[model samples]
Target: MTYPQDPYGQQQPYGQQPPYGQPYQQPGYGQPGYGYGPAMPPQDQGLAIAALVVSIASLVVCTGLLSVIGVIMGHIAHSKAKRGEAGGQGMALAAIIIGYIGVAIIVGLVLVFVIVGIATDWDFD
Candidate 1:
């Protein structure tokens, strides 16, 4: 007995092509893959805002030393965040602002104290 040569002869109706492409021609990679992958959210915005608030507050409260320290930290944080290294931008900015405020307050207070002391007369030999 002779066998039919067409492999798909029995499975498919005579004229139909394959449903998909050839096996070797993969339809992935480089082609738009499946769904959207993981992505990074916007960070550091909060940190920067926090830093600004703290720095301003520190200045008003007359904590010059603390404010200055905060200012430094804020700047560092901001730099890092900008570079996409780490978060805490707000904290860093706050520190810098606070530091400057503290310094100003301290200076002003010192001047007032000195002028008052000089103007007043106290007899102590």
Candidate 2:
């Protein structure tokens, strides 16, 4: 018995491109590569990271001064991120929150000390 031939028997020869549309255009070497989807945002800035570090350290050191500085830096980084001048918005926000908490803790401790000193009638020379 004779076998039937396959449909669309157009076989491309060696080293020959198939009958298709335009070829894929790739980005040049050393050029920024992009995906088929929308472009991604830039990487986070250093100031935001620094703010986070300082705010976290403030809690360990129990110093309100570092907390204040961290809060300031966080604000700056947050603003820049909002304007698209930098990234790390989340980190900056976290830093701000941590800094505020640190400041509150310090203030609460001071109040407690004062209250205890008054209640016990402690005298210092």
Candidate 3:
């Protein structure tokens, strides 16, 4: 009976390891080689993050007064991202959305209070 030859065309006697000087090496698994692909560099996301923070603060503490500033910053950040000058476009968009919602809520509440005040006559004596 003839045994199958190894990759180097050598048929070693049944399960004995190769010589110490010529050890068999296994192929690398699940790891990328050096400089395998192009990597994109990171961009600045300061404006986007600041906008998001300020927008959240407006809703939580400032009663929408700072919402307009947040919205402006968000727009600038979003535009920078669109032009490939920055990152965090999603965050900027969320800031803009939240700020606008805050502004709307403030306006709605003012309108409601005005209507209630007009409907009732209180004597200031």
State the displacement of the C-alpha of residue 55, model 3, in Å, after optimal TM-score superposition.
0.5
**Candidate 2, residues 1-125: lDDT per residue as tens digits?**
11121256433334444334623323233435566568787676899999999999999999999999999999999999999999999999999999999999999999999999999999997
Q: How many clashing pairs in candidate 1? A: 17
Tens-digit lDDT track for model 1 on 1-125? 21122354433334344354422222223445656688777564655666676677776777776676667667867898879877765566556766776778888999998888788955567
Error of 2 at 36 (Å): 7.6
Best-performing candidate as measured by TM-score: 2
Q: What residue runs in model 3 are displaced by over 4 Å at the alpha carbon? A: 1-39, 122-125
Location of the lowest summed lDDT over 10 successive residues in candidate 2: 1-10
Q: Please report how far candidate 3 places residue 102 from its true position, in Å.
A: 0.5
* CA lDDT, candidate 2, residue 26: 31
**Considering lDDT, where higher is better, how would the candidates rank from best to worst?**
2, 3, 1
Off by over 4 Å in 1: 1-35, 41-54, 88-91, 121-125
* Candidate 3 clashing pairs, residues 3+ apart or interchain: none
Report lDDT (Cα) of residue 19, candidate 1: 53
By TM-score, rank the candidates, best first. 2, 3, 1
Candidates' RMSD to native: 10.7, 7.8, 8.7
Quote the positional error of residue 4 for candidate 3 in Å: 23
lDDT of each model, Cα atoms only?
Answer: 0.64, 0.84, 0.83
